[model samples]
Target: MDLATIWVTFTSWAGAYSWQVIVTLAIVGLYFLIDRLTIPVLSRSADNARLTESSGDRAVGLARLLTGTLCALAMMVVWGVQFGSVLVFAGTALTLLGVALFASWSILSNITAYFVILLHPTFRRGTFIRVLDADNYAEGYIADLGLFNLKLITENREAIVYPNNLLLGRPCVINPRDRLRGVGKLPPLPPLDVVPNNE
Candidate 1:
């Protein structure tokens, strides 16, 4: 084609899809900005929760996964994917996932609990804790926090892999003296009962 003809063709094509290109770029840029803002917040929360660096990293990874998923969905919408179709597909996939996970409900619970432990101040790595279960009471130093369980090293050196869900439900006693190995001190706890019995 002649230069004028090529130029015309290129301009027409670009004009036809310019909106799509802009929307795509905007969606991607928005995701990047959100990711940058979110990661440090998660990391800071992890630090406040007394989670290990590895745990903080894992939390950041999870946040990234969620962010990416949302961004993908937005891109699909921006690119003119039918929302109803997307919903149907997502629902079907989730229903299948629910059935598959039903048999391993505890596993799912533990995975959820992993984030809870990472973001909450109650359970942290390296501290000593006692799980008060009538039948399976256990005490140990927090060794590692895994996706499905918390690893604990007992005073006798026995390693215990306690499921995160169980820990969440059970009564836990944290030893104030057994702060995280590298963390200098434990954050101050709330008052014993936040009240005095004047009766």
Candidate 2:
């Protein structure tokens, strides 16, 4: 190659390459647009499915990660890497992809744990949770339900972080559900019309 061609190809930053920048931006933009458009549509479709429902978060997370990787690789090519280096780039990309997936899984797992706790009939902010398999117990108000762990404030006011998987397996004492049945005889109330006369 000519001296000028070689210099431009090997030494120019990715931003200096007009075509690369344009193409990469276009792909990234399209990826975001498509993601935004498909999410609600797919969620609706899944809602209609009788047998099962898919987690929109998981699908969206996967798409965003893969698309971002593609954008990064496009930038790398613009940096003038040789064709023979593509395999190396591919391997690097795969490593990055694995890491991203691992992190996403961790976050998703934590979020799922909190959701399970909120759904239990007897679980409330101040309820106690006891794991059947594990010999641990968390008592106090449920401070926060995180994706990977439960944030519980014990009676002594200590914060506890319990893994999502463990929280899922634990049995919760649901106050509302347990209290739904008649506990015993109730005190008699005066006539409802007379009691509300002030209002």
What 10-residue stretch in candidate 2 is worst by lDDT? Answer: 175-184
lDDT of each model, Cα atoms only? 0.75, 0.54
Candidate number achieving the greatest lDDT relative to the actual structure: 1
TM-score of every candidate relative to the true structure: 0.69, 0.38
lDDT for each residue of candidate 1 in 91-151, tens digit (9 for 90 to 100): 8866765664343454676767777777677666677887767544677888888777898
| Candidate 2, 98-135: lDDT as tens digits | 66434434545545454444444444444554333333
Clash pairs (backbone) in predicted model 1: none
How far out, in Å, is residue 78 in model 2?
Answer: 5.9
What is the C-alpha local distance difference test score of candidate 1? Answer: 0.75
lDDT of 2 at 20: 73
Q: After TM-score superposition, what is the CA distance of residue 41 in candidate 1 from its true location, in Å?
A: 2.4
